[model samples]
Target: MRQGINPSKTDNRIQLESTHRVILSVYIPNLEEEYFKHAEKVFKLCLESVLYTSHDKTRISIIINGCCKEVEQLIYSYKEDYPLIDQVFYTKENLGKINAIYSIVKSNLEPLVTISDSDVLFLKDWQDETYAVFENFPEAGMVSPVPSSKGYLYSTGSTLYYGLFKGKIRFRDVQDPEGMDNFQKSVGSKLYDPIHLQKYLVISNPKNREAVIGCGHFVGTFRKEVFEKSPTKVCEFRVQGGSEEAYLDDPNDRSGFLRLATLGNFAYHMGNTPAPWMWDKLADLKSFEKSNLQTYSIPSAKPLSKLAVLVGKFLWVNLFYRFRRQFFGFLGMKEKY
Candidate 1:
């Protein structure tokens, strides 16, 4: 039976005010193991850091990807406390990382979506710096707050081509060695040689605004339109492997957009274990000031023709890979690797 004179059909729907949305996928199965003993605390810090640093209008979506009931309850409590937490999805079974992320990203209405891991400590001004990169580089499709020393090697053919012809790309002194060192320590891997900490490839615009050439995948902001080119089918990998490259990285490049990062580190990967420095850094972080929210516009990426794509692939495979030293040297890389 239908109710008479229901106002639902005639009523206007509410509009979302946010321009950006942050997506986080958490998969903490249990806390019994030594590896996950401190996972809950670390996750709390990650959430707090984002809430503290993000703009008031920015929305946060948390995908509780088969986490324990305890973790779910904790997240629910956070949702109640923070108004910025826009949505929380819970799954009884574990969906792979990329699958879980795509489920939300596909339907996201915001123009900008930031896909972040469960344990990244977002520093202050991360949004500002990221937006600055997008404002300066109209071709940038993805921007990471944490810069990588060897990031220039990633799917950056378009950036390299533009740099060569425009003479805007060059090697610059690394801005934050301590921040890079912290990232290396967090991952427990030697990601860079000593010389890499001293200098890295950067691209600058006519306005003298500079950004790193490439970015890491742990955390990055993407234009929502780029994901429109991603495959509609679900990813096959359970966790890592080829999932990131297939779903996130390749689409941007194939669409002829540049992948870039901020000149300095504005986020830290806090891995599984909670280090003392993580807490110290969290304590040192300042709250986001409303006055600091600057208005800026991000230009859409110009789609490349089929001929341009074929030419880029040929150059990347033939010239760039075969004569790496000579090619990069021409773009102002001094050292011969």
Candidate 2:
């Protein structure tokens, strides 16, 4: 039987009411390299997906920094369609992306905050499933979705995973094409239609949070304590790419935190200029539904048997850790080594 999700799941450590709050903030800086029109299309799909999947009390923030007048107007236009967007910040100058994010971190408005990029698509169950991690593990410092590709440590998509028994578990991180076909067969939609794909975003039992050392903030969420308890000096200088993620790295126990990524892809990145990840493959999402489509399945959530987990971990690693190179290509690295 499919189990319903607990929208208000929270950690038992903190004695709060049954309800929990999460804020999602997106920072959009005008890219000198990207054509604003093309970027606008990607951003709209991002907002459109957000509007479809978010729940009540989940606040959305859009921080606009030195964007073109057209870009500025596009963001505001979202306000009418997506009421979840309660906060919008307009920065006078382009202090760069990291600085723009730093300003939101300073606000201290919500206990959990997600630093989402402008070019992303949040699939069904994305919001609640995201909250499930923080609710289940209060110790979790950060969480990101498995990307279509370029997830680095958290990548899923014909990628490799090492199991627990003597570097044993070796399985494809996910099976997208087969899963998508299964979903379409169930939904009666044609192949490659993005709308039909949402129904199959089933949640899996994710337990390998410790395997990765850091997270990619392209669509990552973090607890406010990671920053409020950090007690680190804030610098005026800017650090590029994965800079915000550096907070969780905390090399010398400076900040005690753990970084994690979701089991399957909950959200996807439509790479922008300078870094175009899966854009050629995903730019077609705009042809999807104008409203939320509800015919989806929530997979049964259960932990695997200890012996099963062991077999998955030990048996597979022994057989395939060497051949992982051929299956994963150069971009996909073996976790066991």
Candidate 3:
């Protein structure tokens, strides 16, 4: 369903008139036998999350990077079916995540843009929280979710890491192992307990206004000005990682550019795992506010990573943590998500 827009009437005191609508760009690569085996399941989880949790005004744009006719048809079908999906663009060649995002973003840099991966599940009111942050703090360049998985890259910690300094930016900390059991049940996660260890979402503490400042991005939200100021090369060359998100929110200068992760996780990275946090969380999260939202789920989407799981287990055992850390781990060679 398409979201209704708020009236542009300005509050005289604050003089804030919000007309900005978020545009989400999802990159869909071909997932035949050569690609991910469970492509349909992964795609369904990603799409459903956006449909349910996003702001009503949000528009989704799919960037299909290859010339897969079936995939193109699939995206078109979605565009036609959903009123909220604004556009579907396909390229003849396969440009990976970095370049594909750069192509669209480089031109339409005004509206707030969400560059999302296809295998993600979003939580309740994810768009409301994100939009609130942007409206509240005009300086926030990027907003990410406090991830349960992909902890190394995007775990929203109370301690914000600067170049050398670590400042304690307080929020409700859910680092405890006890809460993990409940979260898994809420999302109907199928992965081992160990995977959930990294994939937990810290419900945003209402009192805190702090952000992680410069982050790792599975799903990254960026303000318009950040892109307008960046060079095309910086946007293009994220093959190894850092350059992609560097200039967006330089941690050392938080006053100028604020980088944030949603206080409570608004989304989950469905890396190979396919549990979306918004499916049924009102009861499990007593403190969580679920007003207009009900339950969301993709029962048809099952995990198709049995073979990948085996490979990951072998790698986890054969290589010591320290050995993996030394190599191109500075790059994402060691990363599981």
Give the best candidate by lDDT: 1
- When sorted by lDDT, best at the front, the candidate numbers are 1, 3, 2
- Window of ten residues with lowest summed lDDT in model 1: 286-295
Question: Please, what are the lDDT tens digits per residue for candidate 2 over residues 151-246?
Answer: 233311111222222222223334344433432343354634442232222222245332222345566766665565442555444545555544
Residue pairs clashing in model 1 are none
User: Rank by TM-score, descending?
Assistant: 1, 3, 2
Better of 1 and 3 by lDDT: 1
TM-score of each: 0.93, 0.56, 0.58
For each candidate in the order shown, give its overall lDDT on alpha carbons. Answer: 0.84, 0.48, 0.49
* Candidate 1 residue 327 C-alpha distance from true site, Å: 2.3
lDDT of 3 by residue, 234-318 (tens): 3444343665435443321222334555545566655544444433442233444435643221111111133433443344345
Between which residue pairs do clashes occur in model 3?
3-56, 148-198, 148-199, 148-200, 149-198, 149-199, 202-264, 203-264, 204-263, 204-264
Question: What lDDT would candidate 2 get against the real structure?
Answer: 0.48
Instruction: Please give, for residues 232-296, the per-residue lDDT of candidate 1 as tens digits.
Output: 89788878787898899888877777789999999999989988888887787644465666545
Q: List the candidate 3 regions with Cα displacement exceeding 4 Å.
A: 1-29, 147-172, 175-214, 234-243, 246-255, 273-337
